[model samples]
Target chain A: QQQVKQSPQSLIVQKGGISIINCAYENTAFDYFPWYQQFPGKGPALLIAIRPDVSEKKEGRFTISFNKSAKQFSLHIMDSQPGDSATYFCAATVWGNTGKLIFGQGTTLQVKP
Target chain B: GAGVSQTPSNKVTEKGKYVELRCDPISGHTALYWYRQSLGQGPEFLIYFQGTGAADDSGLPNDRFFAVRPEGSVSTLKIQRTERGDSAVYLCASSLNGRSSYEQYFGPGTRLTVT
Candidate 1:
């Protein structure tokens, strides 16, 4: 019930195209959701985050869409570039629970030049 | 300003040996966390500390895994009787104190290889 399942073990997108990754969860208690980007040999960095109060949140070229009813969320990348290629992970945590994150299986995204 | 820094970028040990990994959080950050990431997978939380005491450690895999933050600045994760399955990249992160403290900054991580 604590698991955050992510789809598309790997994705390849062309430059200037749209890239999308999906995730689903069973726990409804999770009020905070965040996406992280990790490059080779680097720790995962927070990219964008959203709370259950809002349906969507956008930060520059990255956007997160959330569906409270479906227990699902997704990350969209506009104008995909090679520099955006990396491993992306979706995570969830119940606020005030020590901020221990439950992460989904990562998605390896490759943007072709 | 420096981000979280971890010592011993890499460590290799034989089965049954013990090892300790260290983390130095950013200055004035009162919250610290430790996580372990296996190859091709996302990280899993291991423990959390607020000040000099461990606030939560339910994510710790077993008694063989222990951590301590005696001075509220640096923390050490100790693994006893290390097994080959224990090999993974151990990550450390820190954030400010508040309800919005979830915005953590992570370190480069220390990769442990148990043979």
Candidate 2:
């Protein structure tokens, strides 16, 4: 079963516009939610993460809004740019799963200039 | 400092052949993980190593898959009698420790094709 589910398999946004990707999970044991950005021929890089205790967390232009009760989390990119075009994956990890991550299917975002 | 590194970025082999993929983790990192990713899909966990021991290996698909981390540094994933269904990009990741919250740095991945 897919523990984590992501929406909008693909996305497109203009420069300076906001881009969003959403993910939902069914496992309540998940405590850590993270987002990863991957470009072609490269490994996924950590973008932003949030714990269940926090409602939201932001760094630079990347933000993660988490809702524990709803078992959902979303990533928001402010002022999306062409360079932001890549694949984004949302992941969830249980505290004692030895850092094993359950990843979403992935979202390919395109930022048009 | 160098990040995680995998050997033979691409490997093509015939079905029923044996193959070994290597991963060199960052210096002093005690946690290592192996994952397999298919085209257009996210990576799936295969195994995890804490130092020289495998703390979790439940994700391994079958007995044909095995991994080892000797000397608490580099690791090798061995597949016996590989099949076409085994074709995928194998990714290796490492962190400072095997903690649940530590960020895992990933390698470029080794693409294995079983024909």
Candidate 3:
């Protein structure tokens, strides 16, 4: 029940296109969902996050669409650029639970030039 | 300001050897966490520290894995009788507090290769 499953193990999109990655979880206790971006030989960096209270949250070119009933969320990158090419992970954790994160399998996004 | 910093960018050890990885979180950050990421996978939580005490350690895989934050500033992850399966990138992160509202800043991570 602690697992956050992500889909599309790998994706390739051209520059100026939109890139989407999906994730689902079974734990309803999770109230905070965050997406991280990682580059080769680097640690994962926080990209954006959302709460179940809102259906969607947008930050700059990155948007997180969340569905509380389905226990699913997705990350969308508008105008995908080569710099956005990296491994993306979706994670969930319960609020006020010491912030222990359960992460997805990760999706490798490749933005073609 | 510096982000979380980890020492020994890479370490190679033989099976049964013990190793220690260190982490220095951002100044004044009160929450620290440890995670391990295997090849092509996301990081798996290992432990969390709020101040000098471990708040959550259920994610630790086994007794061979232990972490300590003696001074509430620097932290260390110790692995005993390491096996080849222990090879992975060990990550350390910290936030202002253990609250979900605060952002957790991550370190570059230390790669451990057990042969």
Candidate 4:
């Protein structure tokens, strides 16, 4: 069973538009929700994260909106740019999880000018 | 500060050959993790190290796979007998703590191919 699930296997957005990627998880014990961005031939990099206590978190142009009751979270990119094109993965982990993380399949995001 | 670094960015070996992948975590990061990613798929957890010990290796597939972190800084993932099924990009990540809230920094990854 997939503990965490990500949707929109692929997405295409116009530059300067809002790009959104969504994820849902089955484990309620998961307290940490994080999103990672990965470029071709490069390792995954932390983009933004949120805890169940907070409904939203924003850093620069990246934002993570979380809904605990719904068991869902989404990543919003304001003013999406071409450079933002890459693979985005959402992950969840329960506290005291022994450093184990459950990751979603992934979504390939593309921004066109 | 330098991020995590991995050696042998790409490795191609024959079936039944032995291969070793190396990982150098960020300085002062005590927790290390290894994951495998196949084409068009999400990364799968493999093993984790807390300090010099393998705190959690439940993700390891079988006896053919082994990893060691003797100094709590560098880790080596060894496969005694390589199989085509082992072909995937091996990723290394490190975190400041083994706790769940910490974010992990990943290396470029070592692409392994067995034929």
List clashing residue pairs in candidate 2: none
**Which pairs, if any, clash in model 3?**
none
Error of 1 at B108 (Å): 0.7
| lDDT tens digits, residue span A58-94, model 1 | 9999999999999999999999999999999999998
TM-score of each: 0.98, 0.98, 0.99, 0.97
Find the 10 residues in a row with the least total lDDT in model 2 chain A: A93-102
Candidate 2 regions off by >4 Å? none
Residue B25 of model 4 has an lDDT of 97
Model 4, residue A38: distance off in Å is: 0.2
Pairs with steric clashes in candidate 1: none
Q: Cα deviation of B49 in candidate 3 (Å)?
A: 0.3
Compute DockQ for each candidate against the true complex. Answer: 0.72, 0.76, 0.82, 0.78
- Candidate 1: which stretches are off by over 4 Å? none
TM-score for the A-chain in each candidate structure: 0.99, 0.97, 0.99, 0.96
Ranking by DockQ: 3, 4, 2, 1
Error of 2 at B104 (Å): 0.6
Once fitted onto the true fold, the runs of candidate 3 whose alpha carbons sit more than 4 angstroms away are none
Question: Tens-digit lDDT track for model 3 on B1-115?
Answer: 9999999999999999999999999999999999999999999999999999999999999999999999999999999999999999999999998874447889999999999
When 1 and 2 are scored with lDDT, the better candidate is: 1
Number of clashes in every candidate structure?
A: 0, 0, 0, 0
Candidate 2 share of real interface contacts: 0.71
Q: Which digits, one per residue and each the tens of the lDDT, describe model 2 over residues B2-112?
A: 999999899999999999999999998999999999999999999999999999999999999999998999999999999999999999999887684469899999999
